[model samples]
Target: MVTYSRAALFILVVFGIGFAIGSTNLPGAWYAGLTKPPFNPPNWVFAPVWSVIYVLIALAGARTWERAPRGPGMLLWTAQMLFNFTWSPVFFTWHCTGIALAVIVAMLLAIIGFIAERWQADRAAAALFLPYLAWVAFATLLNAGIFLLN
Candidate 1:
């Protein structure tokens, strides 16, 4: 169903912001220099995976906002976004894998909190985050393993 409503605009704006942030934080020279585990995905994989994840995130956020404006879930959502924005900078820009793991862990927890709290208000909204939650879980493990290996 095509939507041209406020929620659609909100989701598009969120997606644009997320896309900009992620595009600017690409793992350039600093990431290439790092040691990687055998399971590390090829560099090309991240963009597609994160693109889908970001769409899901935008949908989840817009759903939650539609259900409850200025609510606790929104706070959790903001917290997750804050920490989400930190991971790439910490890992790629700062070259601090360990700190990046911490950042992802916090982001994961915030996603969980957002899901849990959001579920009460909008089950569909909470359900939308399941994929994001799963991805972050995988990312947290990957980050942890990278930190330990390198």
Candidate 2:
């Protein structure tokens, strides 16, 4: 069983790092200048959505860690996090929409992989990732839109 301290640590590390990266790589003039898709959400929408998703992600990670620390599920979780962290820097900082699109796509795949890898062994952990998968799928479309429009 995962202790509360372990779960709290996972949540803190995951959300804290994601928040820091987001704070650091904000969309400024460059992003403002880009032609966004009609489906693109307002800037304010991202924070709340991501905040919820990050908690879900952390919970899933903690569950995965407790069940299969060195298994494929954990690997996929780590990959998704890396890809997740890379997206803002690639899109906002480097200003590479095309590369960011690719990054987001990879992230989406990693999310799916994590779900599949954990579904049988830990259905709860896999279920926890469903929202992340959905959001990233939408984000992938948004990224593709931005890349194509620009």
Candidate 3:
């Protein structure tokens, strides 16, 4: 079983890195200038939603890492995290929404693969990633819609 304190620390680190990455290029004029889709969430909604999602993702990562200790599943998890980290820089910082969509899609695929790979080692690990997959899938569509609308 994974230690709760260690798991909590892992969550904090992951979310901190993610939050830091996201903090650099906020929804400034560049974002305001874009043609957002009707379904695009209001500016106020993202923080709460992403805060929850990041915690879930961190839990998934920490649990999987503890269970498998850098196995193929962890590799996929790392891939997903990389893709996760890349999107904000591409979209918000570089203003490359199209490329961000691609990154999100890749993240979605990586999460799916991670789910499959982790399932064998720990069902809880696989289960933990489910929400991350779902959110990314939704974000993929949102990204696509943004790219299309813009």
Candidate 4:
């Protein structure tokens, strides 16, 4: 039986992986060259918000994994996670905002599907994903704004 503490630790590890991937040799200089939208948040805001969201995402995934180890739900979770990890490299390092935006849309769809499946297995897991979905929806708008402005 997985204790709540163990699950929490697993979530933290997942969040750390995401944070490390996002933080490594980020292209801050490259970002200055792009024409961001007028409403773009400052650079600092992104790290904190994403950190919290990633933790939530990890928790949601862990909950689902506990309930259903291998299934369509897990596959969708993995697909979205892969997409999530790739977005930083595409946007921050490669400066491919347009491509990243497209990938993010795909990621959003995968998460929606994952949540739909998880809703049946564990409603808390599905609910845990709501903030992530909301943030991604906001991010999609932001990405579109950046693409248009830049």
Error of 4 at 147 (Å): 1.5
Global lDDT scores for all candidate models: 0.82, 0.93, 0.85, 0.82
Clashing residue pairs for model 4: none
lDDT of 2 by residue, 1-150 (tens): 667887899999998999899999999999999999999999999999999999889989999899879999999999999999999999999999999988998999999999998999999889999988989999899999988988
Q: Per-residue lDDT for 1-150 in model 3, tens only?
A: 778986898788888898899888786898888887777778897788788878877778788778776689889988988998899989998989889998998899999999898787788888888877877888898889889988
TM-score per prediction, in order, is: 0.90, 0.98, 0.93, 0.89
Model 3 clashing residue pairs (backbone): none
- Write one digit per residue (lDDT tens) for candidate 1, span 30-70: 67876777778898888888888777777777776766668
For model 4, the superposed segments whose C-alpha errors exceed 4 Å read none
lDDT per residue (tens digit) for residues 38-134 in model 4: 7778878877888877777777777767767787877888899999888888888887889989999999999899889888777887887898898
**What are the clash counts of all predictions, listed in order?**
0, 0, 0, 0
Candidate 2: list runs displaced more than 4 Å. Answer: none
Q: What is the TM-score (0 to 1) of candidate 4?
A: 0.89
RMSD of each: 2.0, 0.8, 1.2, 1.8
Q: Rank the candidates by TM-score, best first.
A: 2, 3, 1, 4
For TM-score, the strongest prediction is: 2
Better candidate number, 1 or 2, judged by TM-score: 2
Give the CA lDDT, 0 to 100, for residue 51 in model 2: 91
